[model samples]
Target: MRKFDAIVIGSGQGGVPLAKKLAKAGWQTAIVEKRWIGGTCINDGCTPTKSMIACGAAAHVIANSQEWGITVSDFKVDLEKIVQRKNKVVESFRGGATKGMEKTEGLSIIYGEAVFTGEKTLNVILKDGGEEAITAPHIFINTGTLPKIPPVPGLDTIKYLTNTSIMELTKLPSHLVIMGSGYIGLEFGQLFRRLGSQVTIIDRGKQLLKHEDEDVAAAVKKVMETSGVTMHTGANVQKVEQIGDTIRLQFTANGENLTITGSHLLVAIGRTPQSTSLQPEKAGLALDDKGYFKVNDQLETNVSGIYVLGDVKGGPEFTHISYNDYLVLYKRLVNKEDTSIKDRPVPYCMFTDPQLGRIGLTEKAAKEAGYDVKVACLDMTRVARAIETGNTQGFMKAVINANDDKLLGVAILGPEGGEVMSVMQMAMLGGITAKQLREMIFAHPLYSESINNLFMTLEK
Candidate 1:
């Protein structure tokens, strides 16, 4: 058996950096990856998807160029070239991660699937065919989640795509039918629609982005609808069947049985943690009812020396959250500092045409938490930047504490909304109040400048 000071299973966002830190701290470390080097973010999720989104966005802008008084003769989406470009971006990122780890001393990259054989020992089934045993006192599990496939009848017989497999398509789909209207579904739905596919998004929930405030969700749905993306809410998918070259999806919506046919079906309902295959029971670890590792605020599992980080622990599955997991663990274990995952302001962005960026609590959440809240809203149509750029379709909203004028949360659903939300993220971090933001001098004609206008609409 080969032994190391630390063993990290899965070279995900948290694991990769954590492994490097452990090794640089002068401890021998072994990082095991079953498939790709950079996990989902680099290999399948963020990099490739966003690259395709960019292509789709460009296509969209060019298609509508006539509105800008720019005469365009003809344009067509080259799916082969788009796929090649996305692959290049993924390879570049993966290669960099691989090289970074390779250059690090005292760190070995084990290409295999690691199953816990004991509390401190792991047996790896090598990807290239071999077996090896490794033991370490400190074990970190960052084995992220995989796309969940719903148990729809006839689904197994048909060739359907998950988020990962869809990236491999070299030809644009004729019609794309997506299950679930969550962030993933909406982003890809808009992306494919912009890429010239007939896109339809179906959701079992009553509203798109059901977790958001009603107004916020409505605004997103409106933008998507205006862009020609069809939506079916309160839709319960009953079964799926392949009819020759097309797929027929049967579902019930609004008490009506309905069927939709499409060239491709993407199941983006959700993701499942990879803990089941890890055999956490052997390590004296238990998963939650939802299949995530039951972790404490410190991200430590029930096992004393074992830690669980990233999506496998299953809170907010964002790349930044995974990175924060590494920081939390590094501070506690290495710096001997007190830190936790509790009550942290989690920020996320959806890369839809007019992106949706959100952080902290929503108005509904603030009200539920018993906060005397003041809400402010500003339409992007009124923003100088939005009008100038001709992308005025969404709005910006801020929820503030009525008692102390403290900024509780913000949601920006406009062009470059994510970047605008980052500014608010910093303001919240600095404890800046709604009044302060309203009076602050922001650079003119920018999406962020709309924040000043947003807070100005608050009832004093």
Candidate 2:
């Protein structure tokens, strides 16, 4: 039996930083990791995928260089090199995190899977055919989610690519079929399509992004469909089978049977925060209906000393949100301050060719929340920078409070849309009015300059 002042399960975004803080604060800490360090963002989800997405973006630029009056031809995409570059970037990030952990004093990293044996006690199954029993008065669970696979007929018999495994492929698929049309589906759908794959997406929902406003979702669908990607909305996937070298997928649309074949298939419906390993019941931790830990504003679970963090808590599963969880916990525990997860701004972006940056409420959400809303919209075709650069696609939208004229929500779907959305996010944080934005002087011929025009539509 071993004892430590604290134990952190899973070296994720939340656990790694919190573990380091506790050790630096003179608490002997041990962090257990089932896989690699630095969690999903470094190892699988964000870093490697974004690296590959950048490669796709480069290809897209060359393919459309004629619009810029530059003739580009005879281009060959080296699949091996693309995968190599992504791997190099991921390793660089992981190595830095590993080195930081090694340098921290009074901190131990155990390579194992841990579960609660009792309240504040853990039994870890070590990697080397060994076991260890460890206990601490305070324990943190950062066990994040895994990609979920749906139970379609014959799906188990044939191997299919996951978001993680798809990135490792050195050869491009002739045709790629994906199930689920959310962010993961659309991003990867455009990514491989730009890299010269025939891409098709199937979704059970009637729309690509059900959470977005109808107009915004329509624009996204148009952008993807206009780029030659096929979208089958309201699809019911019946089965999957591999015949010869080709993978076959069957679905029904509009009460009609349909079949499609592709060289690769990706099942990206959603992610599930599985409690199979952690055994939260052993700790008397209360979980919601969806299996996420029921955390209070301070991020504590039903068990007083055991706190839950990251995707396992289940509100917004973002890398930045996970890091914020670490901050909230640190301030409450170390600084003795009243920090919480209540009403923190959540900002997210979809890395398509024309990026989509979203913050705060949607127009539908604002109206549903009983706000008298004024909406401002500007198409990219109307923006000078977009017209001059020849990448004129997508639009920008802002929902304002009709009474106070303060910004309620914003959706930017154009080049560097995320950057423009960040400016608006600051506006919201500072309680800046729509009138203020219109009168504000922004550098001319910039994408963000459209903010002024956008509000001018509403005020004028």
What pairs collide in candidate 1?
none
User: What is the per-residue lDDT of model 2 for residues 414-460, given as tens digits with 9 covering 90 to 100?
Assistant: 99989999999999999999999999999998998889999999856
lDDT of model number 1: 0.93
Model 1: lowest-lDDT 10 consecutive positions: 451-460
**Regions of model 1 farther than 4 Å from truth:** none
- The true-versus-predicted C-alpha distance at residue 22 of model 2, in Å, is 1.5
Alpha carbon lDDT at 405, candidate 1: 95
CA RMSD of each candidate after superposition: 0.9, 1.1
Pairs in clash, predicted candidate 2: none
